[model samples]
Target: MRTYSLDDVYETRKRRDSWWTVYFVDPVACRVALPVANRTRMTPNGLTVLSLVLGMVSAACFAANHLIAGAGFFYLSFMIDCVDGKIARLKGTGTPFGLWLDYVGDRIRVVLCAGGLAYGQYALTGDVSYVVLGAAVAVLDLFRYVNAPQMKRVREAVREERQEPDLLADADPLLGPDPLLGPDPLLGPDPLLHPDPLTGPDPLPGQESERAGLGRTSRPRAFFRLFRRLNRFLARHRVRSHLVSGIEFHAAVFVIAPIAGAWALIPLAALSGLLLLANEVFLVYRMWLFTRRHGAGSPQESREHVLV
Candidate 1:
């Protein structure tokens, strides 16, 4: 209730929400933004829009081949991206609009930043490869986005089933005020720790059999056992993630891209394409596997299609 500069939003975040962000950009930004959050009229949605604007400007700078300036904006945008969530947590004014704003802003920023960098490189060097690379990144990025909401549901469902099976009758408990993560930060707002705000319609509730039993599946027990373990692994790991994580991709853009000079995106394109492909494949696999258990007529089957 005492929302003010005195609050250290970082203290309230989930451990898995942050790892590198906690180490690198956050401390300085938190010191600067906490007071602003207390004094300014900027809401979390405003911050989300601001971050997107900064990213666009940064991309413009990169397109013009201003590497250092682009990096400066990139980090600044990232820092503010972090700050918005802290403010949201501090003020406790998160809404679905703000959540969606934050999520869309992140996706747009990635497109602009990567595209701008590639175009700038091509402009400077007159190579079409950079242009191709940028396009490829965008395609992979789109593919990754399609599955984001689905993967999020799968993880949330799995996590909930393990913790409070009874409460899962309600739709994605986290989609509303998430008790597990606390106030959303940015996209994840939980920390890299953020939620992917791409929630689709919740899977329709089916009999208990849909979740764990396929009508005529060969081995219900073993199938569910493996399914739980796979889902658990995907949900728990911070590093690998299901795919489309920003850490490796961001590092490449901000670090490797600059260091490599004109060829920054060559490896980045490869990395992104592979990761997106893998993620889409896994998403499809999980959908098929889960739907099979739930049966074709079940609601989960229909819900999973929207995720695609």
Candidate 2:
């Protein structure tokens, strides 16, 4: 059996995980589960598959408005989602297939959960706002999924070029960022695209995370009066804001708002939509600025740029 310390598990995670997860959710969840998981022959992929199974069950409960069970399964699945990677770190057996499974599974699981919320609302109150709210949340959620990896690819590409001037020069030249990758098979088979494994779309390139201490780049230095507070705040907190935003927003509609009535979805949708608009605007502007500042150079210099 494999054995590991808490540090072994958590050290492998991204530095900028949600504040709540870092302090509360992940610590207890991953550490507690890892010991048991290590003792079993179960691989990290096994744990991920189990999480997906639980998510499916939770989705069913949500559709039926079985909030208690739905919440229970949802939390359990999330905990497992956190644990699987930690387990993989301990085992040293991660694979391309496992990465793709985890990525695709996350998107599918979230959509299913959101669909459940919509179904619950329609069943409980016969209101159509459920449908609208569900669609909006799905769009925003998918946007985030697409946005994160693509930006990461851009940042890492720049970093790589800086690190190896001789190497990148001999390699193929850089292509400017495209928010969307080419469509994957609606039905069948193909191989290589971007040679750099980090930019894969169907199964995104893996993230290399730093510690929170290393993650302080987002914040602006105090007493720097040039940029407005709002822009400064957005730059500083953008990544952290996204960590819990989707889950919390859905928890309201699927878990709390359901208690009020389907009508509650209307206001919730409005709030979510407003936030989505603001964030998208900020993201597009940042991307534009990043491309302009970097100007197809390989310095990987972050300077005032929120590339991702």
Candidate 3:
């Protein structure tokens, strides 16, 4: 009802629709209850640790073939996952450590869900599909981290290149007329146009110095200009935008879709894993293209200097 920032929307989404919610919708009111429960007591960090414990118990219950009960515990675990942040927000104790803990806890909850489902299937029907699917999802998480480094490097490089001199050309003559001229007007003479005694002679003795300095860049530099134009276009709308879309897909299809269905659960779980992995590969290719066009050292240096 009140005005909320993008961060608020993201926080709310993280609480309500995560991997934990996928397989566990027991009480249905868990989402509503989380914030309230958190208001009574406990820090976000405490709630996160509690959520992990609850998630483990939920997995154990599922392994024992207690479907409804396991689901219920899983739901509670998900609720706690939501509560941690709510509690942090309420107590005004949100911190980087709390954020990191929540992220790690969320991943662990997903693992617990996959493991619980597998264990449930093994107990109920002895099928190994769930376990295998769980493992696959676990492995796929690496993609997000893998592509992150490359993207970071690319972004850093772009930032530095954009920071290049604002003037159209790199070698603007106005910068320095001559090494010997030194800015003092009182100097014996403007050193720039003066012929250096050490050199044999100017190519064209009669012509002025400005005439001889007409062309600073060669053909290769012109080619770089064209490449820079293409790079600017891609950076504005293609590579980074696509990665953002992939992340949105990861949240919606993999996490939210399963919560919306029962039978769709397993399929969504598998699909999410694959999509996340594909996103990583896409990122790698994008970064590789950048590196090839620019240089690896440039990108790497940019990444190293990046504060984010």
- Which candidate leads in lDDT? 1
Winner by lDDT between candidate 3 and candidate 2: 2
What's the distance in Å from true for residue 75, model 3? 4.4
After superposition, candidate 1 runs with Cα above 4 Å error: 1-7, 12-15, 18-22, 150-244, 294-308
- The parts of candidate 3 lying over 4 Å away from their true place are 1-39, 67-72, 157-266, 279-308
lDDT of each: 0.59, 0.56, 0.48
Which ten residues in a row are the worst by lDDT in model 3? 179-188
Candidate 1 residue 195 Cα shift, in angstroms, is 21
Best by TM-score: 1
Question: What are the per-residue Cα lDDT tens digits for candidate 2 across 184-300?
Answer: 101001212112111122322442232113345423212112223232233233223333345555555445554555556578656755765575565555545544544545344
Which of the predicted structures, 1 or 2, would earn the higher TM-score when compared with the native? 1
What local lDDT does model 1 show for residue 193? 28
Candidate 3, 1-308: lDDT as tens digits: 23333344234322112222323331343344354443345666887898889878766765565555656666566667655655455345667777677767766765666676666665666667767765765555544544454455454455366664211111112222211111111111211323221121234555545443557633333443344444334433212223332234334433354346435546776665666567456546544544455453455556566534
| lDDT ranking, best first | 1, 2, 3
Give lDDT tens digits, candidate 1, residues 196-302.
Answer: 32221222567345544544553544454454444334436322233345444575565456656655458765775676577567556654554343343435644
Query: What is candidate 3's local distance difference test score?
Result: 0.48
